[model samples]
Target: MTTESAAYTADIEAIAQVVAAVEHSQQHKDPDEFLALFHPEAVWTTAGGKVLIGLDAISAFTREVLPAADWDGKVTYEVVHVFFIRPDVAAVKVRQRYLSPGAESEGAPLYVMSRQADGRWLLTACQNTAVATA
Candidate 1:
């Protein structure tokens, strides 16, 4: 493989790790860890349609809801696609699933991540949509 290809793969892997951390934080209800993955000026639109602008708003919403979420099992997030808008920006499509004793549901979330000057990726904008069944 070319050096460029290798570097790109490494970058994607790093981004995947960040995404995994997001899943971890949510499943474990650790708001601090989840909030740390977002940029200070990030925006998030929840699955229920509440728009949170900036880290403070996001943190408030997450802290208030995540811990009180009434899921009997765990939540899992998987990266389904990754589109690079630029060398420093990416649009990630994620499949999120909640599994419990006798129920399951899913959501599709699009997360826009930006690579910081320090080479770490932080989520900058995101939208979570519930997967409706027909």
Candidate 2:
């Protein structure tokens, strides 16, 4: 589990569940559900380029934005890649699709997740970037 290969091979499904939860929370506009996926000192950068540090800031942002989001419960998140920094840490790339019919868009989010003592993965740091049309 110390080598990169072992780390990469470990917990792929478990880490994916974290991303899946994000999709679900986003689709449902459930701030609490989204907040539960973060580490206590997690950092998140929104697609709009706002930087939020710690759970408090992340929580505040999510509470306000998620509830007011106009996605209309149509969205999906897929883990496209995962690179292990350690046995308990991974850098995950995700494709986030805003499935709002005619106005569909996509986001490429990179999440640095860490496994907790209880073996649960939480998002430790992340940057969400919008995929602009050419």
Candidate 3:
């Protein structure tokens, strides 16, 4: 592979790690860790349509919901797609699932991540949409 291609692949892998960290923090119910993945001015919209602007708002919402989540099993987030808007910005599509005893539910989340000057990716904007079934 060309050096440029190899570097691009490395960037994508690093972004995936950041996304996976979100799932890890949520599954472990550590709001601080989850919050750390976002930028200070990040925006998050929940599956239920609540819009949280900025890290403080996001922190408040996550702290309330993550810990009180009633699922018995665990939650997972998988990166389904990643589109690079620029060398420093990407749009990521994620499949989120909650697994419980004899039941499962899912959401599709879109995360807009930005690469910081230090080469770390942080979520800047996100929206979680519930997968509806008839």
Which candidate leads in TM-score? 1
Cα lDDT, model 3, residue 102: 83
Candidate 3 residues lying further than 4 Å off, grouped into runs, are none
**Tens-digit lDDT track for model 2 on 5-46?**
565555898999999999999989999999999999999999
Report the C-alpha lDDT of model 1 over 74-120, residue by residue, as the tens digit.
99999999999998899999999999987889999999999999999
Give model 2's clash tally: 0
Q: Please give the lDDT score for candidate 3.
A: 0.92
C-alpha lDDT (0 to 100) for residue 28 of candidate 2: 91
Q: What is the lDDT of residue 77 in candidate 2?
A: 96
| lDDT digits (tens) for residues 28-114 of candidate 3 | 888999999999999999999999999999999999988888885399999999999998999999999999888889999999999
lDDT of 2 at 88: 86
Over 4 Å off, model 2: 1-10
lDDT computed for candidate 2: 0.93
CA-lDDT, candidates in order: 0.93, 0.93, 0.92
- Best-to-worst order by lDDT is 2, 1, 3
Residue 113 error for model 3, in Å? 0.3
Worst 10 residues of 1 by lDDT: 65-74
